[model samples]
Target chain A: MFKKTILLKDTSFSPEDKTRDVFTRCLDYLREKQLEQDIQVVRVADSGVYGQGLVMKVLPDATLYVNLKDEDVTRVIDAAAQNKTIEGLALKKAPKQIRIVLRNCGKIDPESLEEYIATGGYVGLKKALLELTPDKVIEEMKKAGLRGRGGAGYPTWMKWKFARQVVADQKFVICNADEGDPGAYMDRSVLEGDPHSVIEGLIIAAYAVGASKGYFYIRAEYPLAVERIQKAIDQANAAGLLGKNILGSAFSLDLEIRLGAGAFVCGEETALIASIEGRRGTPRPRPPYPSVKGLWDKPTVINNVETLSNVSFILLKGSEQFASIGTEKSKGTKVFAVTGKVKNSGLVEVPMGITLREIVYDIGGGTISGKAVKAVQTGGPSGGVIPVDALDTQVDYENLQKLGSIMGSGGMIVMDEEDCMVDIAKFYLGFCVDESCGKCAPCRIGGYQMLEVLKRVANGQAKLEDMTVLRRISQAMQKASLCGLGQTAANPVLSTMKYFESEYKQHIENKKCPAGKCSALSNYAIIQEKCKRCSLCQKNCPVEAIPGSREDGFTIVQEKCIKCGRCLEVCKFKAVSKT
Target chain B: MDKLTPEAIDRIFKQNRQQSANWIKVGMSTCGIAAGADEVYATLVEEIKKRNIQVTVKKCGCLGMCHAEPLVEVCVDGMPTVIYGRVNKEIAVKILDKHVNSKALLNDYIFDLETK
Candidate 1:
């Protein structure tokens, strides 16, 4: 086996990669020195660092050297062989992503309770029961300043404190794992990765609020998450953490898993409570909020999977410790599923006040296709678009709302130049319209009308005056809708119109899709100058829009073209053009 | 499975922490499993037992890097703890041979992120 290994990747913007050449030269130099058998050199797909010319990581020593020149290859090999340090070339990487909510994730065996306890998982719950009273638990949460991570940004302490104040024979706490956001799955990961953490958190919430029972309202779609949580509950019960006086105290609580039938509106508190009571999952207007009157008309507390996971962490690692990590207003970290055209798309937990630019470029490694980011869409359907210019703005609860977006469950979708704002807005609005419960007329009717206007806008049939109509319907839905679902459903439409209004105007005035995303307004044609008599586009077209021979050359029948852009993608010579 | 008292939590914590010193953790969450972590996990277990390697293979959750799934984090006696991403069955065998048996670290696959 090789003694030392050097992993190299040329992360430059140039299309022609020089990693192979550099790898070969390093091998040649090692062979010349007769050190080839001692040291191994390999080319990697991702060097984990981008835009830093040539990134080479020397293993065993774990010395990272970036921006290497062709001449520096011999010096790097020599330094590694001699076990000498290179000061100028070493890159010290500081981790941008932090994990508090995901502390035990990937660290411990999630299914093993013994392993979880070893990681100090249930110590928080033990402290909450033995040391602190219900009021004191809420006070500790208040010091932590953790807001509800399930979109609304309500203070977690305040919610529990309200439920604590209500005099009732019985109270309930629910872990809302019904993660229905289009591209968000932070909850499922946490549940599947560290089910015991969530269970411990839910038990602590029950203890803090003086609840005798709790439920895990996870969506049926996450079968693995459900299975793990069920096993965790069983383990907790067997360990006397649940179904009795927990940890040899008077605090007795039982936990159950309630699976949602994949209704998006069930994520709302009142709707969730109604679903738990075996009713049609629909939201009821607040003021007799769930904290005041919830499941079975008794007081209830519903903490999201992410929110509760943080509770146990906050208690274990003191509230002051959790309080010190993030900004003044939005304390602690937020787990964001960074998806869409992003390069390194995954679940990233970053402390509040970190800018979108840092999250996208530094942590996410920018877009996958390496195109200019047009906008970063946050908060999913209920959130809004943030223009590329405002990416520097610090991410907090209030900051994002000012941009017409709530930090809705932390789904950050990066959009490139090719993604039309109008089409994107329509897609989100279409999802909300489909998932709308239709109990209230404003959401049912207003959402339908606004989607119709957006469809008209995409089809190039909308007028400048139609903007007023869209706003009117949006206002109606936001005001007259019964719950959070309808109230914020029009956010995508409103925010896209606010930020990318010029792109929308291009659709109306120029009768063109700026990104060529709206198929109704875009057309595809083959350019003869670029065409190399390739008939691949003709055979690949699903609609048979391109009908021509290789020798005679082909023309796209515009009327028959579905504008799927298959020809644009399949064309090897770059013949197809979309306009 | 006696109901654990408050003291037993601490007892369990101490006992499990000292259970093993060297092991390989496979990310077995939905994302990792979907990326064929099951195969990577099975291969590691089979290779460790077949090769009589004095290390254990365990399952854990996703490490937030779903884009690079089938992530395997290894902790050996001499080498620093490192995560290897996008690992397949072939790479699994190579990790055992090179990183475990021969006492050399894998070059391209080590994703070392020092957390705060």
Candidate 2:
């Protein structure tokens, strides 16, 4: 029975939360007017704006007003009660996200073909099969300016054209759902949320490239995504939309699912095809690219899960419409799996040119612990650490690359003050070394050797010259590694060294981990002054490292301590300290 | 199942695509299931049936918010369609009881991403 709804939030980083003050005033005014029943004012955790004071959103109209003064609460209540705008005080919030690829994600029932069709899902497949020719489809793609969403920003139309032009007896269109990036899963969500759209895109790609067979090279890790895709394929086939002759056209295509053995290298297209063909999943040198000779030495077209999902939208709502949303170079929306240390860690699909500040703060709802975000890791291990100062740099293939980071599979991990840069670098480098295929020397040997050097550095056993060795091995891997895996293996280490060398220097020179994350170089102890003879730290110590009871103030046995910080957390009195 | 022609596709789309009156959609993606969305979905279905609420319970894909897995989108007639993130059975029951039946938007759960 409420006539109006107002969303209130104090988005400022200031100590005092003005949200309660604003909410109380609004309620008081409404109660004084005896109109409390007519209006509902709710305080929200996030209003999508950061560092802006007293954000108020009037619902039904969704009129947002930001930076409101204490005096303006009565004015806001009066304006809302009268159903009138507050004129200049009304906040015009420009939407920070665009949803071309994720259009049907939260909106429709993904499992229902009828719901998908209602939302204009397979109309692209219908149009492609009956009306548009292969060349025309590629032409439309070119006009749309669609690029590959699989980190490498290759023009999608050119890849299609190459596959289409190749006169081959058999051609294949593969959906690269092998999203193996550490923090990236935009592909999985799209496949799960809007499976039909990706399927529709795959169908169109099949027709465009004259491919009768297609495979979805999904990783075994994503069981739900696999299940949803299987259900969608079944649904599509049952509806006669995917069989021998789809939509009654001569261009017949059949699709199948292939599970990856959870190898990160398999995300690379050549490695993906090799895995699908029942060969060992490893990247081969690309001489005759996948567009010409791929998947059993036949012509093949491989598009990422996201690129294909955009296909159906492009076909249904013309190429120009799809082209209109994003920046000039990177057209359409890019879905980011925004994770780590951030408050709203999830998938965010924004226009290509939107700043990282907008993405991290406006869309992602800022850092989780209310700490200053140190750096944002993009493109997974293959990408680099972008410091907060450079957050305003437009996110695109070229811009990210210019900042020494590639948009590898859209994994954006935000790191706050607590996360050690050197530790993070070592983790990624170790992942690459672990996942290295060992077919090539640079990736296999270089990745391992570099990881060893990083381990030595983190463990406080390496000299300054060892950093040179790390650099040399990294350069060698970048220049000589067979595939993208070996080539970008050194990114994490190199980027961290570039941005946070002081932290690394502290580890190596001072023999100290600034964040106390590297356990080998750090020690745990109890400060005598702060200890209130509490037995809590003594009891909770897993190793029984604290050798005293409450009678005598507890002291940590340094040798017995694993530096786990168990005592530090267990101590109510500020007794335990790690150094 | 007839092979859909362009004309038939248009007709079927128009006839079938009207907005549903009320429903609960749980994100059934890998992340969501890992966060116990299956149990949530099953509980929602079972609870709605037991309560005899005239609303449909369905499963959808991840809405790209994997951090808050087990996302639930609720759209009831005369209520604003809002997505509730990090939903468990307790929150699901609250969503059904408060949001659906009582017509009140739950506090601290609605994720209003301005998706265009």
Q: Where does model 1 sit among the CAPRI classes?
A: medium
Predictions' DockQ, in order: 0.56, 0.60
Candidate 2 TM-score over all chains jointly: 0.96
What lDDT tens digits, residue by residue, belong to model 2 across residues A492-528?
8898888888888888899988877899988877789
> Residue A176 in candidate 1 has what lDDT?
96
What tens digits encode model 2's per-residue C-alpha lDDT throughout B1-116?
A: 55566687888788877776798888887788899999999989988988889999888777777677788888888776767877889999988998889887787776655644
Tens digits of per-residue lDDT, candidate 1, A1-579, equal: 556778778988779889888988997899899997778777766767788898787877879898998888788888888887699788887667678998888888888998899988798888889999989989999999999999999999999999999999999999999999999999999999999999999999999888998999999999999999999999999989998889889989989999999999999999999999999998888889999899899889999999999999988999999999889899999999999999888888998999999899888888899999999999989999999999999999999999999899989999999999999999999999999999999999999999999999999999999998999999989999999889999999999999888988999999999888899999889999999986999899999888889889999998898888899998998888888
Candidate 1 lDDT for residue A536: 92
Enumerate residue pairs that collide in model 2: A193-B61, A347-B64
Q: Which stretches of candidate 2 lie over 4 Å from their true place?
A: A14-25
Per-candidate clashes, comma-separated: 0, 2
